[model samples]
Target: MNPAEGAGSLSAAVQAGLEGTGLASLSAGVRRLMDAYRSGEVPAAPVLTSAREVAAYAAYRMPATAAATGAAFAQMRRGLPGWTPATVLDFGAGTGGASWAVADQLPDAAGLTLLEQSGEAIRLGQAILAESTSGALRGAAWRRWRLELSDAAERAAVQDSADLAVAAYVLGELTERQQDRLTELVTGAAPAVLLLEPGTPAGHRRILAARARLLAAGYDVVAPCPHQLGCPLEVPGDWCHFAARLQRSATHRRVKGADLPYEDEKFSYVAAARPGVGSPDCPAGRVVRRPGQRKNLVTLDLCDRDGRATKLAVGKSKGEAYRRARKTSWGDRWDDAATG
Candidate 1:
């Protein structure tokens, strides 16, 4: 489905899940949750401890999470073309935001499994997904599984065969060692893996670390990166990330106490697949930043296949290239062949 339609469906599902919820309680829960997230420290206990908190989280965070994950999924689809996962495993699934995002991309996937620790989260997730039109989502299995790095049985259980495994916005909650272990678990579960985190320097670093591990495991880089070479933005004060803009609903605005009709969800992600599973259609480069346009010139900041970040200026003299460059936005694949 198109993005607009998918978003509408997601909004409807969330609204359906939120029916009969108390707005005052939801707003209070949102404030507390926002404070915890803003503090940047991992909570020692489950964040969604009650139905009110779960409802608040679903109404407040699900849309943005889905939008960001959808953006990442879009890139993955573009890179892999005809490839589709028959089964999907979503680790740290939360309210199944990542699963919904995957459903938006591959609606016909036969199976989906969501593993989360919080029972409340699982309950709300099941309710939210039950409202989805996609059969895969409606039939998704919600498992209450805590991430324990050293538990052999747990690890084996999480390694169920699947085509794709996703862990989005959940890395921050783990220790560095746990993060590494989770990566191992996901990679063991599926040939293809996608990881996403907030678009912060620390988040980018986490993704870069996971990317290195995936490459070491012989997986091919699929999206955002055109080549398997080391990241060029690894230097201090620079990080690779992308943004997805989503419209805020009335409930969203009230919970966040924001008047803006839209919000941009910035995220850092890496999608990789084992050898022979999938390969990226190597573009000339990717637009790493917003394109700047002038009267007759467009400047694009690109991370090219050579693993270098540089700027390209397309002037009116370049004809069609200039037109395409002018229309290009951040996070777009920059194909020199198409431009020329």
Candidate 2:
């Protein structure tokens, strides 16, 4: 699919919804609140939203994030040793929406644990999992999935229980103290953890803090190079926004209704793994095509390294379209310029 073309509609809808949300007006205040809480100058609780709002947000963003997360996990899967454990955990698993992100990719994983803190959230997640028709998690003989309602206190008990742990857009909700506690739990429970966050500045800050703590604890850096560089923005703000579009099944569209949007948001994320007997060896950066070209030529440039690159020319397209003046003299000049 041509992201440039399809993205316009998705972008317009997202922009409209975001504008209606008054988030632009609240961002500065939210950032201030987050900063104050981070510095211990103020105490703040996790910002709560309506169930509908959470569902809308998840429905709009899950497809893209899940696809990207799955791809990243697939890349890392190549580097894992045969002896890597078969069980996995989804820590801070909200409604278990994200387990679908990596579920199919790690088919060999025998046990799947969804560790959530809220009984309500776990129930919602369990309901969703039970309704899936793909049988992705149910058919495999080694598969065993369960939702466990617990907090940081249970971390040590399940320490080293999982080969992989995922915290998708969960860390930003915690206070500094809680973030630290959860970080410790993740580092101890699993050898590799994919920490996903919203593409917003506040989300980035949370991940940045967690990255520091994880690195300090000796976790090996995988994708997303510059595991150490600070934010580059002269003045901080949201850096990037991405979207993922998938064809909705008839039943899905009917159940969700046309009023509910189908496009998904693609926020930025980083996948980190532990040292030895771990994920694929690679760096992370955006894939792009060559200059003055319209074809679908793809390349993955590793970040944090010098100006190094690897390229692959995948598909081709016709030359760009244009219009010229009717005048013969002007047309002649235009033709000459085109030839030149």
Candidate 3:
């Protein structure tokens, strides 16, 4: 569904909140902060430092972030349909965008705990949630705490044992040691964890690092990649990311100064569940790139369960497979049942 056509209740509430506030007041600050984030620099302090900044960010970035997060979670559901999470732990929940994504996907999720450092962000998120029709989000616990990977006590406040734990766009600011510590803490707390980053090369590397750590800790891989083996994207000059296209609402376009009706949010993510918990079965591989179509042939690049990348060609003479291939968009999956 297009985000503009069907925004989650929390997102709608966020938009309403931004509209009530002077959203344009902090537009310049939001643009500057976003540029820094795009450049891969994690600031030491909160980017949204005031009501205006928080509102500006909510108006400008929330839709795209929520859309990207929902796409990642959809992949997780495809891989683990049997895994129904009752609770979620959102780390660094800026205006609770990711939490809203979780709520949109996991309708039965009755609990939410958001850990964030900035009081301003927390207040804005609470305001949005209060305005939301979603009972889960409205009832969520907004915990104001700094993220400290070095301190065990502090890390414990990150909701150590939720059914699902999410860290969206939060790892880039930390050092390697901090990342490792954060991973250890999260893995210890939750049986299932989802980590998301920007679509940049650095973001994919972060996902790879988390994947390795999770696998070593006895977690099973789910979504995007079908196998637990080392990533095949190790070749130089290559990275793995997925794109999610979201429709831009009028306010969203105005805030971001984007004239396009739709924007594609690119993200790299890893979702994994521990050994005892069973996940649903999905396709053995995913179509990582857009299928190229010619007069009669559809060509695709696939990432397989064996941790290999291979190209496949389906001609018009190929019957049903070709017909199916013609319908696939990027970030879609297919298996032997359909193509072999």
Candidate 4:
């Protein structure tokens, strides 16, 4: 499905979940949730404690989450064309935003499992997904599993094998040890893994760390990074991130008390797959920043397969290369062939 259709479907599903709910209470809950997220401290308990909070979260944050997740999935598809996972496992899935993204991006994913600690989130997720037309989403299994579990057997039982595993906007909520454990669990369960975090220095650091672990575990880099070597942006105060712009609905605006018709969800992500599972046709370079244009020249900042970050200027003299550069946006794959 196209982005507009996917957004419309998600908005409809959220509205279905919020039917008969009080908008005043939901708006207040959204403010509280936003404050909690901005505080940068993991709450002592599940954030979606009450049914109202879950609804508030679904109405407020789910769209942006879906947008960001979809952007990451698009990059993954570019890296591995024609690859589709039959099964998907989402860790800390919350109200299933990532699942919705998968349905839109990889429609052939037949089986989906969503693991979350909040009972309210699980129930609300089920309700939201039930409104979806996609059979894969409607048939998804919502399991209440805590990532902090210490028992090996309990952890193993919850770690069902799948073709792709996702942990989106949840890693920062765990302790260092818990993060390590969750990484190991997901890596063991799936041949491919996708990790997403807020587009902040800390978030980029988490993704970098996770990328290192995946590489050590014999996984190959798939998206965002063009090479398996160390990230060149690892220098202090410099980090890699991208933005996904999403149009906001009327209800979304009311819940967030914002007047903007759209918002850009900045996020950092890493997609990697086990050696043989990754594509050999990964792009030679990825546009790392917004392209700068002036007169007849367009300049691009890219992370290339050579494991280096560099800038290239395409001018009108370059003919087709200049046309391609003019149309390229941030987070797009850049091919050297375009210049040749």
Candidate 5:
């Protein structure tokens, strides 16, 4: 289905997603409710997270998600530090883990607003905040974090005015129309908005769309190419997916209590914001290409000046069936005579 056509109700879209899919399971009643929400056959209400200790058939991924987001925010600080943003809006702030990422960074900021439409999410955010900041909350100017259950449109008028706005992995949950609307909302709220995704093709596609919109709107892009460049061919598929594996610690595994799926590459993200119009030095990813090389040799190079790349060797077209070389090496580093 076209994502753009479903922009009117973001909640309905998410409610539908909560129903069930091959990747995740949902109860039959929940499926019916979600379907009704998606079709707009019924009015939507905020649904909170069940509970912190609500026996999950799986582990509570909140801590890991929160930790990863905090790390990403730290990277954002390294990239830009001149602006000490006063107000922040965390859009699609599921359970407030990403919001904690923002709050942790701007500990002294005046206002931290967590905008979520789910009642469950709102409750979870409040509970986590209460537990995490019990004593030190008063040290921050705005000791109390604001949890509001509101739609994106309702918040758009005052959106981009924040110092920094973030929409992390949440973009994947949004439909096409909702994605566009949400982007516009964040851009409206603050001069600099950071959009992070799972680093999948679909995730990258959403970031690309935001880049196009922000560029046309005159916002400078900070990280990742906003130029909408073609794929780099790092993998065979349309998107890049790597495995991330972490050994189960006794304490950690016990906390999660499920056979955690730890792949080598679990997540990826891009940091984006309005570019300072005249400021140069935009970092770009490396691109490798070979115009003409030996039948089995591929060239290694980067398209950008700062971009760096290495190459590997693989088999050329075959008669019966095609196959790849056993090992690959950086194309430029390969000694042609020795390689041949």
Candidate 6:
């Protein structure tokens, strides 16, 4: 995948829906609410409260979140090329951004079950779906249900879960133990599970814990990791992350107080296939960091199929592979074909 992908440009229909919501004046206030969320001030409550907060979060975070998640989906595609998911179960589906991303990846997605604690977010999601042109998304079940790590009833209700499940940016709020429990809950709910978090030490830590549990449960990693081996980059001040850039609209700029035309969403994610699923075919390895290009050679750091890091230097004299290395960006699946 490109280090930066364009996946979540706001649709005209969505923009029009927001306009019809008559909540345009609340954008600035919602931006402040987002600031609170970033600071972790709004812990133990819904990040989105009123309709305006929902609109603000949808405008300010949806595009970047969708773009990042879409990149992760692309990686999953590379890993599990033959698997096709017909249904999606979204936990903590705020504004339904991740659900929309799922529909984008699988146009044939026939069922969507979204459970969120915030009624406000669910309402806004309904509005967005009402204006959607996709038949699959047009008919969705977005509900207001609290997702507790210890709620057996909730887990039981998800027993009749879908083929794919996603939990995006919602795990950082829990304790490590709760995160571990939630991992089992998520995997139990679907055959394929995707967990994404912000690109931070805390976020990466949560993903690492989830990865350990998924592996312990005999799950095979589909993307990001070439093999089921333990992550080798355990050094301090370093965390595995990928980046995706999305175009921001004028309303998005005003809500977030930004002047840049585009923003890069840095994220850490893990995508795993369940027990019956087979291991992914890794022709070479995955690009763990951005490739560095210089005069006569390019330096590529790869996490090989066994999940160990190897740094390779390819000079121009090496031929076509070297030429292709120059174009290999971050978050890409590099193979022997590119390693002459």
Q: Please tell me which model should have the higher TM-score, number 1 or number 6.
A: 1
Model 1 agreement with the true structure over 1-340: per-residue lDDT tens digits:
3344344477777878888887898899998888887877777887877888888888878888889999998888788876888899999999999999998778679999999888989988998899888899999998888888688887778675799999999988788998999988988888889999989888999999899998988889888898999999899999999999988777778888999978999999999988777545778898888889889889999999999999998899998888888888899899967467
Q: Could you tell me how far off, in angstroms, the CA of residue 67 lies in candidate 1 after the best superposition?
A: 0.5
Which residue pairs does candidate 3 place in steric collision? none
TM-score for all models, in order of appearance? 0.95, 0.59, 0.93, 0.95, 0.58, 0.91
Q: Report the number of backbone clashes for model 4.
A: 0
Candidate 3 Cα outliers beyond 4 Å, as residue runs = 1-11, 155-160
lDDT of 5 by residue, 210-314 (tens): 766776767765543323344343335644222223333222344333465332223444455666522333333322223235665443333232322333333
- Candidate 1 TM-score versus the reference: 0.95
Q: After superposition, how far is residue 119 of candidate 2 from its true place, in Å?
A: 2.2
The candidate with the higher lDDT, 1 or 2, is: 1
TM-score for candidate 4, please give it: 0.95
State the lDDT at 93 in candidate 6: 87
- Where model 1 places Cα greater than 4 Å from the true spot, the runs are 1-8
Candidate 2 lDDT by residue in tens digits, 62-141: 34456555654554453343434466677766555456657755555566777765554454455445544325433322
lDDT of 3 by residue, 1-340 (tens): 4455455454467666766565366567568767868767656666767777777777767777788889988888878767788898887788888988888776677899998877888988888878766789889999886656578677555545688888888788677877887777778768888888888889899889988999999888887888878778767888888898877766677767789988899888888888666555757678887789999889988889888988889898878888888987778887776583
**How high is the lDDT of residue 311 in model 3?**
86
Go through the candidates in order and give the clash count of each: 0, 1, 0, 0, 27, 0
The per-model lDDT (C-alpha) reads 0.87, 0.48, 0.79, 0.87, 0.47, 0.78
